[model samples]
Every structure is written in C-alpha cells, then in structure tokens.
Target chain A: MSRSFSTSERRVLGALHYLGFGLFLAACTAGFVRTWVLFGNPPSIDPLASHRQYIQLLDRKQDYESAVDRIEIAQQLAPYTAAVDGLSIQGYGQIGLGLLERGHPSTARLYLQRLFLALEQTTELPSDDAEMLDMLARILDRSYELGTGAEAILKDSLLLSLLNNLAWIRATHRSDSIRNAEQALRFASRAADMTKREDPSLLDTLAAAYAEAGRWQEARQTERLAVAQAERAGVADVAISSMKQRLSLYEDRLPYRE
Target chain B: MSQADASHFSVTRLTGRSFIHPLFDYLVIGGGISLIATIVIWQSGRSDIVPMAVVPLILLLSNSAHFAASTVRLYTKRGSFEALPFLTMAFPCVCLLLIALCLAWPLRLGMNLQSLYLTWSPYHYAAQAYGLAVMYAYRSGCLLTTSDKRLLFWCAMIPFLRMFFCIQDTVLGADIGLAWIAPSSLYRLFEPYQAGLDRMLLIAACAAPLVLLIKTWRSSSGAIPMISLLMLVTNTVWFFALEPINAFVWATVFHGLQYLAIVVIFHVRDRLSEPTNRHGKLYHALWFYGWCVLLAYALFFCLPQAYQMLGFGVDESVWVVIAAINVHHFIVDGYIWRLKKGDSNRQVVDSSAPAAAPRVSSPAGL
Candidate 1:
C-alpha cells in the first residue's frame, strides 16, 4: 500500500520544513524585540490613535463605506473614548451631509440616522448649549425637508431649539409642500412653553406661526413683545432689527417667508 | 482496490512529481509556510506596518477570497451541487437575508450576529487544523488508529477551549445575543475559574502532543509525520501567543492562505484527472485559478455595492453577507473534505488512480 517519495523529494521536504521553522522563530523573535523597543508594552494598544489614523485615511480617500466599517471596529476597541465617539459622530455626519448634497436622500437618511444615534450616545456634549442645539436643529430641519424620514426624528427631539426651528420651518419655508401653519403653531407654542416664554427665539417662532395662520393681531402683539424683550435683554442689534421687521410685516397683515 | 487498501495506499503515498512537487505540496498547501507567515505578522512590533497594511489584506483575503471562495466552489461545480442539496444551500442564504432585513430595526441583531461569528471562528480554525493534521498523517504514511485521531482532535481543541473561556468577559460576553449560546449566568459563574482553566488547558495542550508523539512512535514504528506535529504546534501558537484580535487576524490570514492553496490545488487536480479534457496542464490550472479570483472579487466587493444600490445599508449588507458566507463555509467544509467520501476527495487525494477527464467546461478563453 505504500507509495514512496523519491529521495530528492524527501530531502527537499525536510529542508523546507526546517527552513519554515527557522523563519518562524526568527521572525517572531525579531518582531517581539522590535515591538518592545518601539511600543514599550506589547499589550498596551492605543485604539484611540489607531481609530484616528483609520478615520483620517478614510477621510482622505472619501471611502465612506470603509470609514463606517473602521469606525465600528474603533468603537469596539475603545467603546468609552470621548475622542473616538466624537470622531464616529463627525464621520457619520460628514458622510450623511455628503450624501444629502449628492441628492441621495434615502441613503443619506441612513447615515444621518446613525449620526444622530452616535450623538445621542456621547456624554461630552453639553445638553444646554443653545448654539449647538440650534445647529443640530438646523441640520435636522434640512434633513426633514429632503424627504429623509426625519420628521419623526424632529418630532421626537425634546430640545427647545430643535422644536423652535421646526416651528420656524413650518411657518416660513418657501415650499408650500413643507409649510404647515397648524403644526407650526403647536410646535412654537410647545417650544415657548418649554422656555417658560422667556427665550426671545421661541417668542419669535410663535410670532411667525401666528402670522402664518393669518392671526395678524396676535402676530403683531407677539413680535412687539419679542422685540421689546430682545432690547431689554441686550440682544444683538441685528436680531432686534429682524424682529422689528417681522413686527412690521405682521402689522401689515403679511406672513413672513424665507 | 478495497476501501482498506485504498485508504492504506492513499495514506502511504506522496503526491506525484507530475501533478505537484511533493515538497511544495507538503510545505505550502499543507500549512507550513502559512504557519511561519502567521507568526511573523502576529509577533511583529512594527505596528505601523502590520495593522496598517497586513491586517486589511489578511481580512480581505481571509473572508472574501478564502471564505466566500468556498461558496463559489459549491455553486460552480456540479459535484458540489450534488454534495450540497439546493434547499440546504438556500436555507442559509434566506436566513442571512432575513438577518440583514432585521438589521434595519433597533434590536442589536447585527452585534449579535458578529458575536456568533467571532465565537464560532476559533472552533472552526481548530477543527481545520485537526483535519489537516489527520490529512498530512494519512498522506505521510501514518495509519492513525481511531484512538490517535481522538487524541489529536482533543489536543487541537484544547487551545480553542482555552480561548473560549478566556473570551467570556471580553468581546463575546457583552455582544453575544443568544442567551442559550453564551448564557450570562455561565459567564458569571465561570468568572473566577477562567484563569485557572486557561492555565490547565494550556498545560494539557502542551503535554498532549508529547503524549501523541510517544504513542505514535510506539504504534507506527516512528512513522509519525513532522507535518502533523507541526500542525498542532501551529494551532497552539495561533491561540496562545497573540491577543484575541491579533490571533483572529493571524489565524484568519494563515488559514485562508492554507484553504485557498488547497482548494485551488484540489480544483486543478480534479480537472487534470479527467480523461476527456484536451487542455494542457497550464490551461487547466490557470482556468481554475482565474475563475476563483474573479468569483471571489464579485462576491466580496461587487455584491456589497450592488446591495447598497438596491437600498440596503453598505455596512449592514456587507457584514451580513460576510457572516453568512462564514457560517456557510463552516457547514459546507464539515462534510465536503471527508476523505471517506467517494467523489471530490478521491479526485483530489488519490493521485495513484487513473486521472479522470475534465468534466466541467472552461471559461471562454481557456
């Protein structure tokens, strides 16, 4: 039953086997020494740095799919790193925004959804930062307008700025398909109430909502109150001027549009 | 020949000089070079070099080329189709699609799927190592008794068991979805015993090979093949030396290379064995390799993009497909390479017999 190898073949096989073993031992030893000298500790991997490098590479290449893939690995490696989480949020946001700009609204929705989910996971963001809230509000507003299924997201947001922005969009959007005066009034009222009627921006949104609903007298009164409060609170002159102009429009029985 | 005679002949025989040089076949496809390569990449301190370049290449080749290549083989050949019934094959495909669809929800099913894949991978790698050990043993003229096979199987499995226990509180602990697969209570209960168990398993794995060597020496007149022993050592190094993540990368690359080399060799040999084929040896070899590469690329890269275009998320679709392919490979390889089987194994392993004709048609050019 035995089928014998030629003597030469046996010699070759034996040599290759020893050669492989030698190479394996040599490479492993060299790798350990090199790694110890360069890295100090073999097990102490800084996944944060690795994550950043992968992100930068993906960013430069504009490979969004790979970026998303690498980010998941990064998240697993350093699940609690603030910087890593921030990068995940930013990466998803960039991809989502890029997709939106490219007219891939449906695909963009997926990325943006992931972006928002990542943002929700981050503990570093100050929940009370009005400007940040306003920026998120604007982004979500645009996402909703693009038919990206962001309406539910906008509705679910409890942030005062986001609610006010939604109201404002409903009141003054250029497209009739998007404008909804009734919804605007409800959102504006809710946002203004959340601020205890103290935020000038929420008051402004309420005024626009009233105007959009053709309630000229209420719109005029609300705009005047917003302008007076802005001046008393030492708000920027540009904002005060805008409020006054809106007041004039309401007084003339015209709804504000942007 | 009778089955016993055929088994003895096949076990004792070296592959012919005409088909593949015995040294190359034994050293490379039989897992020698891959072992060295795995060690080099796994232990190397050049972090900038390995992860940046080597890791990605390993991932692509291992999963896309190697893992998905198995599925490509299943559908490409009529014999494979016969080996795996259509319904059996389609079951996993349908399940994977459902899983992909479930990813759209908030159930953390993707994480669960990843955990399952990760958990199953070590065992899969160990099984392949055990299988290859027996294969090299049979090829190198060692007629291992049933007890010897059992010993080798346990020895190979020890490293994987050590890995499984050690991983309970790490990645597998948090992400594994199925409670039945890795129950939370068991992880908690085993928490104190993990270190001790790992140490015990390591000791057992190290000692089992020595015991095997002695037993084989006594039973088979010192005919124990170095390749079989080396296979066990390779598996041990793969599990013990590297961290889980690095072990995964190293094992995957090495295993993939080993699998790819063997599958391609098997394909070439199977085609060359055919009596009706008029093509030259080079044409048969190239034709088989060319289609494998093309099919691997299409399945791994192009299909994911097409899924995205069809409205699935790129991340979700790609991971789902990859996971599905891996699960399918694990299932298919369980039976596909059994030497006792009469079809593909005979064509690939029994080089002493008359060559069969090339039954499948060549692609347009070759």
Candidate 2:
C-alpha cells in the first residue's frame, strides 16, 4: 500500500535531507571557529580583564572548577597586580561561599584558603585601604570557623573583628573537637586589650571564652559588664537581653555553645 | 463513516505499517500517559535517580538531534533555498553571532538578546504543540471546519498567553540579564492583571479540549483522535503542573522526543520510497536513529569541549550555540510544515479528492 513518488520528488526530498546535514556541519564548524578565534586568546592589553570576564562567566554557570582554574591563570599572568589579585580573591570567595552553602565544608575550606593565599600575595595594596584588608581577614577567619584548614599560618596583623570572630568560634564552636578554650582566651584578651574593653561585643567574646575555660565567676562578671556597656552604648535591647541570658548561663556554670 | 473508513484516518494510515504500531502511537503521540508517568516518577522521591541518569541523554537528543532535524526540511531541498532566499538565512545567523559576540564582549545588549530568547521560547513550544495537534487531527481524519481550526489554534495559544501575561515575570524578571531589558513600567502595568489573566487562561486552556471534543461529536462523521485531545491536555500539564524550571526541563525533553519521533518517521518513510541507487545505501530505521544520536553527541557534547580546549569560554560558547540553534529552529519550523498541495502534503496526509483511494496498508501487513 506504499504510495509511489515521482523520481523528481524523491530527488527533492533527498536533497533536502542532505542540505540539512550540510547546514548542521557548516553551522557547527563556523560556530567552533568563531568562538575559538573570538574568545580563545587573552586580550593584548588587558589579559587580566579578559580572564576576569571568563571567570565571571564560569561563576555564573556554576562551574567552580573552571573558575578556579581561570583564577590561577589570572594570578600567574599578572602575579601581584591589584586588579588580578582582587579578581582572584572575589572568584575564589564566590566558589568557596557557594560550596559552603551547598554543604561541602571541606571543599569550601580549600577555596577559602586559596582566597587567603591570594590576598596575602597582594603586598602592594594601598596602605590607606585598611578596610579592604580588614574585610578579607574577617572573611578568612569566618571560613576557618566553618571548617578546618589554614589555621597554622595566621595573618601577622589581625584586625579586631577577626580576633573577635576567632575568639567567638573557639569559645562556642558546637563541636568539642573544634573548640579551643586556651586559644579563645588568648584571642579574647588581646581583642579586649586592643579595644580597651570599650566594645561590648568584645567583652561578650571574653565572657564566652571565660565560660569555655570553666572560670564561672570571671565569666559571670564579664557578662554583667558586657550587658551594662551594651545598654550604655545604646545597643539593641534584644542584645542586652541576650547578654543577660549568657550571664545567667555563666552563673549556673554552664558554657555557651554556638 | 464506517469503521473501515475511520481506520483509514489513523496514524497507521500516514506512516507505513512497518513504522507505526498502536502501542508506539499511543506512547509517542497520545502523550497524556507519558506526562502522567513522568510526573509520578518525578514526584516519587526516587525521581532524582532517573532524571539525573536520563536527563543528560535526553538533552543531547532534544537540544541537538531534534533541533538539527528541522534543517532537513528547511535548507536541504532545492526549493527551500529559493523560497527562503539567501539574505533571509544569513540575517538570523549574523544576528545570533552578533548577540554571541556581545555576550562575550560583556555588553548590555547581550542581556537583551537573552531576555528576548527566554520570552520567545514558550511561544515556540506552544506553536509546535499546535502544529502537532493539527497534524494529528488531519491524520486521524478530523475534518476541522474553519471555526474548529481557529478554536484549536487558540487552545494551543492559551498556555503561551498565560505564560506571557502572568508567569513571565517570575521566571525572567529575577534574571539580571532579563531585568536589564524588562522595563519597570511594563511590570507595573501587568502586575495587577497577572492573577486574573492567569486564572482565566488556566480555565480556558483546560476547557478548550472539551469544547473540541464536543465539536467533534457534533460534526456527525468527524471523530476526534485521542492523540489530538491528549496533545492539548499535555500542553496544559507542561505549563501548569510543574514549577517553571522543572516544567522547562521535562517539557523540553518530552517535546524533543515527540519531534524526534515524528521527524524520524518522516525521514524513514521518505527515504524508503526514494530510489536506493541515488540515495546510496538504504538505511534501516535503527541505523538512521544511530546516526542522529552520533550527530547529537558531536554537536552538543564534543563541540563544546573542543571550544573549551581552544580557550573559548566553554559555558558561554555552549549557551550561545544552543541559543543560536533554537532561534534557527523556530524560524525554520514556521514554514516547513505548511500543508501545501504537492508531494509534501500528500506524503503526510490522505488526499481529499474523491478519485484518490487510500493506498496505505493495514498494520498487520508489515
């Protein structure tokens, strides 16, 4: 029951099929060459910018591995240039944060360590931009708090915020394996000394560190002092209340765990 | 019409008996059960296992193989080149290339191009569904009157209208690239109407098939093929039943498979009829499908890797190629399936002339 087609009709259909195949081959070839020629090489004057652009594209696509690889290339290409260092730090930080959010703490720690190493290599950063260094230090400290790594090579000059974060982490880390009462006490005392015990948040960290070390009387006294200072400084009432609750915990000889 | 006459209007009538069996038709064309099965499997918690396993393969076939098949009908034939004109073909390719270059250059216009593509995609899906529905209807011998055709077209269009007015903001608005092009004024204008429009379109889309069914019943001799009704229903499910991302994934896969099935059937039937000497070796259906799979792999997977190795941005290049192919497919499909009086029309549908008899053999003959 097959319908007969004229020879011309068969020829036309066959030609159409071949034409389609040919177009596909042509398009694929053209696209491959066009993309390669256009995006393959780094820009002559701005290789760093080109690498940054490629890294951004990879980040958007969530290809963390390729983004990391691009970061490495950019780092090698420019070494200590502020722009390349900034791009690498941002790229690695993004991948690290993304992995952390996806519950891959160990993998996230590796990226965060890479970010810190990149930050350290940029020694020529303007001395006036202390805030940028402080922000990066805080980020690195937070990453350390999240998972194990990079604890051995501490920054030479730690910002007050980094000290407070590290002190808090050691004082109240939920895992017994991570908590270090002695290190928490050291960081808390140094941070408090630098702030002259004026920052209520620093005093709060000191209280937590005292509690972590089983110094209940000192912990209770520090918590009370923190609450009074916070109230005088017009900290949120909720904060003052939370400080009081911590004082009560110290009064009962119980350590704060967060 | 008698049962014998009704049988003449089936999918088996158009595709040779060797190619189409009832089970195959039901699975591919009567796609309601397929949608239901996918939904059930997806929701079963173990859905991840299957989708994770099958989705990549489906993507290759759907995005590359199915998309590439349209080229056959558009550019291969001598008439197609003349009909399309060289300038018309070059324009889109050049435009897409420009868009890709803009994106690579990190320009704002690339964002606009992306927004436009996303906005246009649902309509493309709807148009394909409508075309397929009409095709099935014609094959099944449903003598659709003018009003019936209009109704069927609107039915196909309703989902896209809903998508455009209501769900578009949620899907595309959050995208930074899309937001660059989407004016705040348009959002303000459409925001209030979105809810009402969505509900109305949902109701209309749901009810249109029933209306079609009733019209088929009232037309005395005309019968509504189950496949036609299923197609409309499946389109509704694709738009409404799943979340936007999931809907995009599942619908694309199903739609791709559907297109592939039909195109393969068309290719096989036409090739078998052609003189073997001119065509070289005659391909078995399986062998033809294998070739399609190889082409898909080369295009979707291998090409991107090659670009990546050459230092082109892999993800961007892959996305650009995919977007380019899609834009080309939509444009090509616009005219390829037009029911004109010629061998093309006769090959797909039975001739309405009284002098012509149904030459298609029954399924048992194969």
Candidate 3:
C-alpha cells in the first residue's frame, strides 16, 4: 500500500503525518510549561492548596462535612496518571473517614464498600502493578471489623492484613484506655511501609498509638520525627501543628514527674 | 483449418466459457425456485412445526445420499484411465453437498418467516454453534490459499465468540419472550455493580474483525499479519478476563464487524480497478439480502402497519432475533463472497497481468 503511492504523494502524506505528530508533541510541551510556571514545585503535592486551611477551620468548628468535602475533592485529583489509581483508593478511604468522624457509620460503610471494590480490582503484586493494593487491603480489613457485616467483606488480603496490624498493635500499644489505639498505629505503620514509606499519616497514627499506650518517651520521639519528615517532604503544616500540641501536653505533665 | 472454420471454433469456445460462468446464475435461479416450492408445500401442510419438520429430514437424507454417491464414485473411479474425470466430478458434488448441508440445516432449524429465525429452540442455538464450527473448518482450508493474516485472525476469534455467546445466552436466560438485554435472572450475577463495560467490550470485539481486512490490505508482506496477531491477542484477553455478558457482546460485535470489513474490502477492490461497465448484479443481490433482513426487522417493529399487514404483534425482544439473523447473514455472506473473490482473484492472476489481478488466491480460480 505504501509502495502504491507515487513519490510526490508519499511526500505529501508523509508531511501531513509528521505535521500532525508535531502538533500533538507541541501541545504536550505547552501543558508541562504552563504547569511549571503556575506551581513552581509546591511544598507538598496537595492538589488543593487551601485543603490544610479548610481542615483547620473544620477542626475548630467541628464541621466534619465541610472537611470531608474538601479532602474528597483534593484527593480525587491529587495524583498524575501514573499514580491516579492509588489516589482514587485514598480518596475513597478519606471519604469513609470523614463519614466516621461525622458519626455517620452507615454512610461510612457505603464509602468503604466502594473502596473495597476498587481495592479488589487492583493488584499489588510488585512486579506487575503499583504497591497500592496492600495499603488498601489493610484499610478494608479494619473497615470490615468496624462496619456491620464482617464476613461479607472479609476478602483474603484483608484477613492477612488484619493479623499483621493486630500483632503490631499488641507489641507496641499496651495501654488500657485506648485499647484499639495500638491497632490503629499498627495499621498505619504497616500501610506506610507498604506504600514505599511515603505517607505521613502512618507516622501520625504510630505517635498516637504510642501515646495511648502510655509510652510517653516513644510517643514524643515518633511525633518529633514525624514533624521533621513531613516538613522535609513539603507536607509541613498539619504534622508540625499536631507535634507542637503534643509537646505542650507533655510539658504540662513534666513538672509532676520531676 | 481455414480462417472461417477457426473463427467458428473460437465462437463455440467463447460460448462454452459464458455457459460455464453462468453456473452462478443457475444456482441463484434454482435456489429461488426451490425456496418458493418449499414455502408452498410448507404453507399447504401448515401444522405448527410439522411443515418445517420435513425440511430437516429432507436435507439430512439428501445430503447422506449425496455422500454415499460420492463415496461410491470415488471407489469406482479408482486406478482406471477414465477414473480421473469421474473422481473430479464426484469431488465437487461432495464439496457442494457439504456446503449445502452447512447452509440449509442451520437456516431451517427453528426458522419462522415472520420472526426471522429467532425462536428460542435449543436446536437453532446448537445449529449456530455448528455453523461457527463450519466457519473454523472453512478458515483452516483458507489458510492454505492466501497469506492474509487478518482472515486467519477472524478465523481464530470465531470459536471464542461461539463460547462467549453460548455462556451469555445462558446467563441472559433466553426464552421465547422478546427480551433483548434486560436485567433478567442471567444478568443478576453482576447487576449490583457497574455499567458501560459491555459497550466497551462490544467496541473492542467489533474491531476484532478488522485484523483480516487490514492484514489483507494490498501490500508487501509480514507487517500485515501483525494486525491479525494483535486482534487475536486482544480478543483472547477480552474473552478470559471480561465476564460473559461483556464477552458475548464483544464476540457479537466482532462477528458484525467481520462482515462489515469484508464489505469494505470489496469496495476497496471495486474502486481500485474502477472497471468500465462493472457487473454488480451478484454484489447487488448479496446486498439485497443483507438490507432485506434489516428492513424486515424495522417493519416488524412499526406496530400499526405490522398489525395491519402481518397481524403479528411486535415485542422489543424481537430486536434480539433480528440481531441474531443479522449476525448469521453477515457470516454466511462473508464466507460466500470471500470464497468467490478468492477463486476469481486466482483466475485473474494466472490469466492476466498483475495490475488486473484480484487479491485473493484460491486453487479453483487458478
């Protein structure tokens, strides 16, 4: 077919093809240029620049719905195409967490169901796909026990993650007041490791778990480390504020110990 | 011989050539008459299923008889001076009978003129499966003749389509009712979750047949076969991972697209030559049947006229029946024209210059 075209015709068609190819390349180049000029390497990959401020406002007013909505929208568009699926799972998880915070357990269950489904479809086998699958499995396992029907959502990976989270929580969080605080720490720590040691929430959860277990020295150390890591990674504000609050609480109890 | 005598001899040869070429003419004319006669007898006998019951019996017996005759002829013609001629004659008859059997039995199985072969009979469904098998056998024979990778690819996907459709129909719970693709007992398996999956699969499946056309595109060599290979790979992936509903839709669309691709191939060849005074009678006839089936589907749906003209109520599910018929017609016609084109291409290549040659290459035409 290529041979059938005359030399002149070949030249014309080839030119047309190359011209279209050039235009496509130019569009892609222009898109990257605009993105760089506008953002110039943000402190964090927070798609919604105002999300932290909104969360702070929500925390002060205790407006869970507004906080949830901001986080949901931000999470949805956070990742580039390479990381979009992971971000989607994270977005669903955040939605569920917001629902739980608002005391809407039934609604939270529904959001968890979508998360479970998305996680089920995704594979975390390191060779084939991104390692998002393991993190999702851990989240779902916790959700399964917390939600109404345990057996209905008891997926194989979820069960595996449940055992791992429980073991970690038992070893670290031995305190009685926050019995499940150790479990939350274990879940978040394992999730962070599974996500290539990237997520800041894992650090936050571990610090909380240690504090609940009355391991004050370990809790303070973990919180300080978490704040430093978040700042270095450009996710500074939230973890830094939380760390300052924890330090003040520790200071208040220090005089009695001395 | 003298010049006058030589001219007369040449005239006779030319006439003989025309007569032999008119075999298709006789086939078409004879088939039409036989169909009319069958309908007349069918109407006169007119008991439900009984009138149509004889069609299968007659076809089976006649085919069996033809097979026996061909076998006997093959035996009698063995190792004799005149054996070659008899053997040649018997061979074609046997082949023709096999083709006739393939077309007739499936066409007859649970066929109704008003409904256009959409009765929910197991026999008809099985017959479609049988037809797909015949297509596989036909394609295997085809692989020997032309180097078209795309045709070979379409050949490969045919079985996957059969399997997927079989599962789909079962899941969908096909009954005599005119349910096209509603949430029935069959679809309940995945009803709780998403939509649009089936349509995406359908598009992929439909595009699957392009492997053949794209492969056979008039060109040099090896690269074209890749198209067929890619189609086969993608189709295999779709068949395995996708659920039966999506899988079946994909298979159906692939089947439809295969036919449409062949039509495109014909148009491409027709335009390439742009032969003066082109005889499109056969092409037109084929198109007529294709369009007629579509027209029948449309007419069946237009209720007031349908009730007045045919007095049979229409259901939306009748569209499924129409679709099934369309699938059958597409595959059947695709096979016939492909065979014809292959034969003609071979003849043109051998007797004329390469420029005037058809693209197909079958031994019969050669």
Candidate 4:
C-alpha cells in the first residue's frame, strides 16, 4: 500500500529530508577534517588532560623542556575549555620553577611573569576561586629572589610561607639578603600558627624562617616535627630532600651542626 | 497481585521516565545559565566585579523563563491545580530579581566603603533565600511550609556575622593593639550554642554525612537520593569560597562518599525489587564501593593541580577536593538512584502536584 501525505505533512517531510541530506554531506566533510586533525595522533590520547598531567609529572622530575612542551599543549587546549585555564597557569609556573632550578634565571623570570599575568587575569572570578592565588603563591615562592616588589604584593599566608622558605635560601647565600629574609621568616611563622598541624610543608617553612633568623634551637625542633608531618602526607621524599639540602647550607653557615 | 496493584507497580516504573526528563532539562538549563553568565562577567570589565554575581543572575533569568514555559505546559496538561505551585515559584523568582536590583543600585549610583560591604550582604541573604525557596519548590509546598518558617528561617536568619569577625581578626593580627575585632568579639556573638561563624559553615558541611545516614536509615528508598544531591550542591557552595568552614572540605568529601553509597543501594533495589537474589545486593554494593574508591583516588591526586590553575592558593586545595568529590558523587549517585526509580514517589511525597517536574531537569540530576 502507498501512503499519501497531507499538505502540512508533505511540507515537514520535505524540510526534514533536505536537512538530513545536508547534514549527511556536512558529516562527511567533518569526518575528513577530523581525520586530518588527528592524522598521526595517538588513539588513546586526550590532549588537554594528558598534557596537563605530563607537565605536572615532568615538573616533579625537574625536567623543564618536556614540561614546557606539555604546558604549551595545555595552553593550546585552553581556548576550547574554560577549565583548562587553571591547568595552563600551573604548567607555566612548574616550567618556570624547573628552569629556575636549572640556573636559567632570565628564562625562569619570563615564564614566572607569564604565570603571574595569567593568574592576575582570572582572580576576580569568585572568593572561593583559588586558582590565581595558588599559582601566584607558587611563583612568588620559587622566584622570591626576583625582587622586593613580589614580596610586598604576595602577603597572603601561602605566598608568605614561600617567602619564608626563600629567606632560608637567601640567609645562607649573601650577607646583604639576611635582613629582608628575617622579616619574611617572621611572616611565615605567624602564617604557620593559623594552619592545621597536618601541614608539614608549612612547618618546614616556619622552621626555615626561624633558622635564618638565628633561632637555632626552635628551628631544630620545628624541622623535626615538619619531617614527621611530611611523612604522613605522602610527600616525605620531597621534604627529606629539601631538609638535607638545608642541612648542608646550615653546616656552611654555623660552626656547630645540630 | 490484583490487576489494579500490578497496574500501580507498572506506573511506578513509568515514573522513572518523568524523573529522567526533568533531570536532563535541569542540566541543560543550569549549563546554559552558567555559560551565559560566564560570557556576561567576562564582558562586564569591572575591576572589582566578582564571578559570584554571574550564576545568580543566570539562575534568576533562566528559572523565570523555564517557569513561564512550564506554566504553559502545565496549564495545557492539567488546569487550575497548577496555579498554586506556579504562584509559589513565580513570586520567589520576582523577589530574587528585586533583591538583586536593590543591591546593585547602590553600586551603580556610586562607590563607597559602606556600599561595598552592603553589596556583599545581599549575596549572603540571596544564597539562603534561594535555598529556602528552591527547597519549597522541590517539596511542592507553600512558602510557609514547616521547613522554611519553623526550621530554616530562624536558623539561617541569626546572621552569625562571621565575615565581619574574620575581617576584624585580620586587622587585629596586623596590629595587636586593635581591640574592635578580637577573639572575645567572637565569644560575645556566638559562644555556647553556635560554633562561631567559621566553624558554623564547617558544621553545616559536616551535616551532609549525618543527613544522608539518617535519611538512609529511616527511608533509603524515599527521598535519600534527592537530599544527597542537594548536600553536594551546598558543599560546593561552602567549600569553594574563602568561607570559614572551607578548611574541613576533606571531611565533607568523606561524608559525601558515604551518601553516594547509600544512594546507590536505593537505586539498585529500586530497579530490581524482587524479593529474591541476595547476590544482586552484593554486586550492587561492590559496584558502589569500586566507584567511590576510584573517585576518591582521582580527586586526591589531581586536585592540587586544579587548584593551581584556578589561581587559588595551595590552601584552596580543599575547595578543589570538595568540588571534585561532590561532582563525582552527583554523577555516580545520580546514575544509580535517579535512573532506577521514577517520579511516582517524588510527585506524591513532594506535593501531590507536578511543579517539581522541572527538578528532574537539573544538571546535578536531583
């Protein structure tokens, strides 16, 4: 049996049939574009998520070049998703930190400044939106030697903790840096008191601050507690390594090694 | 079973479709609002403008539109009985807009210290009021329902003034001689009954686990799933900001996970409620456990980097953790509970009306 359409039905059917044909052609074109876009890409890769994870992992390993590549890839993905803004900022900060660790101060400064700018752009989001604050603190902490300007701006508890750790770094290096370093240490110690006891990293910063300020006995006690707390948080290896580095610097400074 | 009883059971199963539709609708609406708000905020170019301003405006506009469309749909389907729920939802929508307008007027007119502080006060009230109104809408009750007037109004209206207290503490810490905002001030404002402002939010966030537990114990097959989703939303609000209770986010996550587990049980039993098959229960339990464990691990590991990107301080790790945990709970619990059972119970228990037809569309799948 043959079915005949009413006037309205014929009109609707004609519109839908044409639309479907157009969509089929568009889909074919889209498939071609997608094929070209992923010509040599790995089948299992999510470029954004994978790049972000890789940068974080590489930064942990202090591999600056690979981390930078991943960071660029993450940044490329940012235009597609708002959530990637935070990932890009973190990647840049990590790369900058890695570059700084390798003694490339100028390159590190550029990366850190870029990270800072990215964070600054996003800070007005919400009170609870902490992405900017975290990136800014990390940058300020890692590149504290960049200048006094950063020290004045990053007065928040997290950055202050970073500055306090930087003070310990400065205290052992140059005689001219100790006064500002002492001030930073004091600020960090106050910050530590407001935080929970489980945060071993903050305790380390507090201890480092005290040590740089010539409060030797208090520093030793704090360092011991910090080591224990760090172990509990599953970041014991990093803490232990930083502590060992601190011990060597202390031995160089004071004739008596606790 | 009698033919009538069997027909009722089939109807119960059919209720799932209604529940699923509203949930998908809510998601689409909320997502649309968030996207539009993001664009507006990005374009506003206010040095002091906050993202907090965006979502509410989006909600206010989107809800009003959705309500209008729904009013027409309801009127077409079931006449007259729809008006009560319609007016209740409509009145609140108007009030929210009016409140936002009044609050924005001062800032628009001129900027002053008083205006800045005053502007923030409206947001706090808005959050509480919106919450109350939405609860009523969900419950299919009038504004003067027992939950609002008897329970929520008095409890939320106390205005613990935690923000002021925190500001005072910051000033005092900067200068030891500053006496206006001290720990003693907190004692005077909230001592024995309340946990102080900071801890009060923490207390609220912590309540999610208990609420879930009690709801499950009393009626796991009841409103257990919906309440759990609401808890997740509330936790996200509390933990994301620089609120007093933000520090306790990890603990909040634990409670959320437990709630997620119970919600799973409710859904699985709802799907296959035959009086036999003990092993089915074990399978359901294992599936829930596996999901919770996977989510917990992923959130714990990836959250720090998320915080870093959001321009948050490392201390803000708690917020990311809370957000991830709640979203995970929403997805997992929503899949199990909302998909299994339909609106047969919600439509009856909530208000005997279909005003809550829209709730099924919420992104969080409440």
Which prediction has the highest DockQ against the true structure?
2
Report the Cα lDDT for residue B239, model 1. 78
User: In what order do the candidates fall by TM-score, top score first?
Assistant: 2, 1, 4, 3
Q: What TM-score would every model get versus the actual structure? A: 0.55, 0.60, 0.25, 0.27
Clashing pairs in 3: B150-B211, B150-B212, B151-B212, B171-B186, B178-B317
How accurate locally is residue A11 in candidate 1, as Cα lDDT from 0 to 100? 59
- 1 or 4, which is superior by TM-score? 1
Tens digits of per-residue lDDT for model 1, A118-170: 66566444333443444455555566577563444433443465577668877
Where does model 2 exceed 4 Å of error? A1-137, A140-165, A168-258, B1-19, B45-54, B72-79, B82-96, B104-107, B168-182, B277-291, B298-314, B351-366
Worst-scoring 10-residue span by lDDT in model 1 chain B: B357-366
Q: Once superposed on the true structure, which residue ranges of model 3 sit more than 4 Å away at CA?
A: A1-258, B1-171, B175-224, B254-258, B271-274, B277-309, B316-324, B327-331, B340-366
Candidate 1 CAPRI level: incorrect
Tens-digit per-residue lDDT, A23-56, candidate 3: 4345334433433453353112121222343354
TM-score, candidate 2, is 0.60
Q: What is the TM-score of chain B alone in each candidate?
A: 0.81, 0.79, 0.34, 0.30
What tens digits encode model 3's per-residue C-alpha lDDT throughout B294-323?
333222222112121222211211222233
Q: What is the DockQ of each candidate?
A: 0.02, 0.06, 0.01, 0.03
How do the residues A149-181 of candidate 2 rate in per-residue lDDT, one tens digit apiece? 334334534346557766787788787766778
lDDT score for residue A189 of model 4:
61
